[model samples]
Target: MNRRRFFGFLQKEFRHIFRDRRTMLILFGMPIVQILLFGFAITNEIKNVNVAVLDMAHDDVSRDITNRILSSEYFHLYQNLHSEKEIEAAFKSGKVKEVIVFENNLAKNIYSKNIGNIQLIGDATDPNTANTIVAYTRAILLNYQQELNKGSKPPAIIQTEVRMWFNEELKGVYLFVPGVMTIIMMLVSAMMTSISLAREKETGTLEALMVSPLKSWQVILGKVIPYLVLSFSITLLTLGLSMFVFHVPIRGNIFLLLGEVLLFVITALSFGILISSIAPNQMAAMLISMMGLMLPTIILSGYIFPIDNMPVPLQVISNIIPARWFISMLRDIMLKGAGWSVVWKDTCVLAFMAVVFLFLASRRFKMKLR
Candidate 1:
């Protein structure tokens, strides 16, 4: 490779990036906005959720249970209902997310060693929140039961205490940080690189470059180097914000994290190059990157949803998504404080994908020139 020519090409690519305000905004602004949005605004942890109470028994036990649920951070007692008829209206109006119905002889049944029924009705439109609300309500009731059985020996209760490892508090930020980082990296490295290269083809600059002294590999490298730097910077910015602002800890070796970051960057950029080689224009490249890369990264990467929970076909499809492996590595390293031993398989998978993608991209890109 000619050093002067390569350096000149790199400089030109950097200039192109800096000259565009929109590109700069996307490179910088989007990461921060998305991170903050998911960190704070989008969360699974229930807080200040509204609920209506149907108290058929206005006894002390029923009143105490209602008071306990309201006092907790998870639920807010929106209103009291005398009958179950108001539940449908409460849910339909979108005023309350849940309704707690206490049976008529709640206190008597509990005192007389009979099963005291309490029905928890939740709006299942949001299954996740509904499950969480039910869980919290059950926890509160369990606490109340423990209080009642303070001195007495209760019957054999199979108490299952779920301890969430790595993330004890169950903060949504813990779940979102790694996924958000994957998305930002994919967009910056893969999507942006594809668009930038496609713009060259659209503007007829690629033809000039093709006929120039610069080899095909050098030209591809020139286009990639700028996005690589930008993507790395974004990675650092995202990690810093997550650590400082959101307090998501990085427990593994810093070098390991950086190594994985570099691997995934190259992997994503290879995918971008492959897309750019096939797409005739920047618009097509952008759409392919957004729809093809972004959607799979979000859906199939086990970011928001667990892959195991998906159907067999979708679970198999998820294996091909590079983000799935990268995000898995991130979680293992960051949350579990795992070492290379735990994550080496993932690293190998990414490296192999990067090689395969780059090979395909190089061939397709060369074919395009002919």
Candidate 2:
């Protein structure tokens, strides 16, 4: 009789666990999603890096080297430039990672003088990737040089001049500061806001507000304002620490940086409201914020991992993550001294996301009132 009672209790517990959809999702869905994201997203290997070429030589040797670099799986040809002046613009556009410039008489100089000159310029905003790219490029050039010198008495030397733009010293702090700021802002604004709202719902205060004279928008704004101010303060604090302690430079307009930070905070707050509207309780809201916002921000936001190196599906999914745009803006403004012209598109995207999230949240809040 005792054994039968214990088996019955075990069966009842199993049934309860299986019946709870949230628990099942937590058990089954999160692990699979986390594994897939971690497996594909966390990698140092770079692929399909966009490169521009400025071939002053336009000779067979220059063309051969260009073909060699592009043929490798590591790089893709993004543009061909006619002059030296276009290099800065290319890097500023953020589309080109590396630029190859061959001197005027590459093939002739190689054969006659036993020397050829090639300049490799890399964008060092992400120093690790930039270093890896430079290393790969040098290896290719070295292989070509070896091939040419096989029959020669004096092995022809290809003098490669390497330049790392933006972050000349290749500081890791320059890359991480922006990403860390983004994550911290997201946590304080989105996760905290969502959990706060969810707590109100769980405690029945949200329903009381719905029944009161307060408008839906007013109630939502009231919940969001405090968090917004807090998030902005946190942003400023992080910026100060990065500049003073880490020695990260903010070369762009400080006002513009603040404006962008405010915009991103609002966006994150709106996202929090949306999550809270959908969550049934504070625990669910917290879990949703962690699994949905935090993990994606850390993994898919180009914070630690290069988005270009991620798989195509993840790269596409990353576009929807708000941190991706904000982090990019932060890096451009702080590290690259980029102005509004460089970051405007990202700002617009964040604004649009905030509006959409707010609209959805309002609709959901209204439904709860009804």
Candidate 3:
């Protein structure tokens, strides 16, 4: 009889587990998503990196080298530059990662003097990617030099000069600071606010507030203001540490950086409110914030991995992650010294996301109140 009772208890427990949607999502859905994301999104290999060529030589040799670099799986020809002046603009636009400049009369120098010079300029905001790109370009040039030397008396030598912009020392901290800042702000602002609001709901204090004379927006504002201040304080602290300890430069306008930070904080807070509006309790809110916001912010935001290296579907999904834009802006402002013109589009996207999130959250809050 005791054995039969134990069997019945086990069956009951299994039925309860299958019946709870949240438990099922935690047990099954999260593992599947995490495995797929780790498998596809986590990669060090670079592919289809956009590069521009300034072929001043414009001769057969220069053309051949240009073709070789672009033909490789690692690089795609983004554009042909007319002059050295266009090179800065291309890098500033953030579309072109590396620029190859062929010295004038490259073919002549190689054939007559048995020597040629090529300059490679790489955007070093992300130092790791820049190093990989430079190494790959050098390998290709060496291969071309080897091809020219087969059964020849004198081997033609190609002198390659590498220049890394924005980060001369290839500091890994430059990359980590902005990424870590984004992750920290997203968690503190979004997760804490969501959990805080969800606690009020779970404990029935939120219903008490709703029954009071305060409007929904007012209540939300009350909840958000404290977190907003906290998030801003955290940002300032991080920035101070980055500038003083890590020696990362803020070459751009300080006011612009602070403004962008403020905007991102608000967006994160609004997103937290949206999550709280949907979540049933503190645990659900915390879980959703961790699973939905934190994972995407870390993996899909190009924090550690290059977005260009990710698969197409994952890249598409990254566009929706707010941290992606914020981190890009932070890198541009803090590392590259980008001005308003360089970061305006990203600013606009964050603004749009904030508005949409607030609107949806407001509607959800009102529906729950009704």
Candidate 4:
């Protein structure tokens, strides 16, 4: 009930939140640093991957396909083996991530039967990347098939020429950068904020804030405004580094990007506020944030796996994840150079989530105050 005591306590509480080194690092530093690192680590496509060629046939057709793979820059030939025995050695030596084998009758088969089989041996250590590499190898063969089929014009020709757009190089790291940034921001903004706010409740300070005349809105604003600024700055910092240092592009409207970022930030902050309302302590808040939100954001966000490819239930689960919309928006704008016209659906979904989260947070906080 004492006005001076309450304001003084609120100021002290704000200082504690800001001064905590771990929280500052998590809120301000991780978004930029981790996102950039993720950008480099988390790509689904493959390029410039080391590959070995076992051309037992040594024929013109096999030589042409080899040249094509080398020219595509998706492959760097470390060895041109003379025998099948050399293939096992090349694969085991770890000198190559993939091995392309041309059978001894490659030329004859192509000329007479119009079909030549190619064996692609890929390293399964990095299974995701290995799968993509194998896909690329198949694409290379398919390209050759199409090039041959064009002249003879075979009916029912299965030709596939894969063109990886946006990230033409299809480097896994480049894809990881944005995704990591998205994930870290979602975690830090929502969960970290929630845990920090919940700490005061566990310590009995939040009750004091509720009783203060500073107004509940001001107290909530004071707690969140600083972190929001910090998190938003981190987002911009990550984007800048990804664009300049990593050579990533901002292919969409600058204003739209900033606007979406604001939406995402507020969404996270609101979620944090809501968590703080429900959680009785910091540990519970942290656990709820990590398990309930962060994991889903990463898993369902289509950052680590393609959501479209997931099972029906998981795909349904993805609908509730804000990161899912943000990731889709980011890809549309960042990779596809899509405009608001194209990304508006995702933007609307994010906006709706923000409204829902803020509404819940506000309602829960009001009830808590009483």
- By lDDT, the best candidate is 1
State in Å the error of residue 222, model 1.
Answer: 2.1
Model 4 Cα lDDT, one tens digit per residue, 112-150: 776666777777776667778878788777777777777
Error of 4 at 87 (Å): 4.0
After superposition, candidate 2 runs with Cα above 4 Å error: 1-170, 367-370
Which candidate, 3 or 4, has the higher lDDT? 3
Flag the better candidate by lDDT, 1 or 2: 1
lDDT of the structure predicted as candidate 2: 0.81
Q: Which tens-of-lDDT digit does each residue in 92-191 have in candidate 3?
A: 9999999999999999999999999999998888666888788789989999999988987888899999996332334556666677778777876799
Error (Å) of candidate 3 at residue 105 is: 30
TM-scores of all candidate predictions against the true structure: 0.84, 0.57, 0.57, 0.76
In model 4, where do residues sit more than 4 Å from their true spots?
1-14, 39-51, 59-95, 103-120, 124-170, 367-370
The lDDT per prediction is 0.86, 0.81, 0.81, 0.77
What is the C-alpha RMSD, rounded to one decimal, of candidate 4?
5.4
| Native-to-model Cα distance after best TM-score fit, residue 177 in candidate 3, in Å | 1.1
Model 1, 227-307: lDDT tens digits are 999999989999999899988899999899999999999999999999999899999999999899999999999998988
Candidate 2 lDDT score at position 180: 70
lDDT of model 4 at position 174:
59
Model 2, range 127-152, lDDT digits (tens) per residue?
Answer: 66777688789999999999989989
Best candidate (score: TM-score):
1
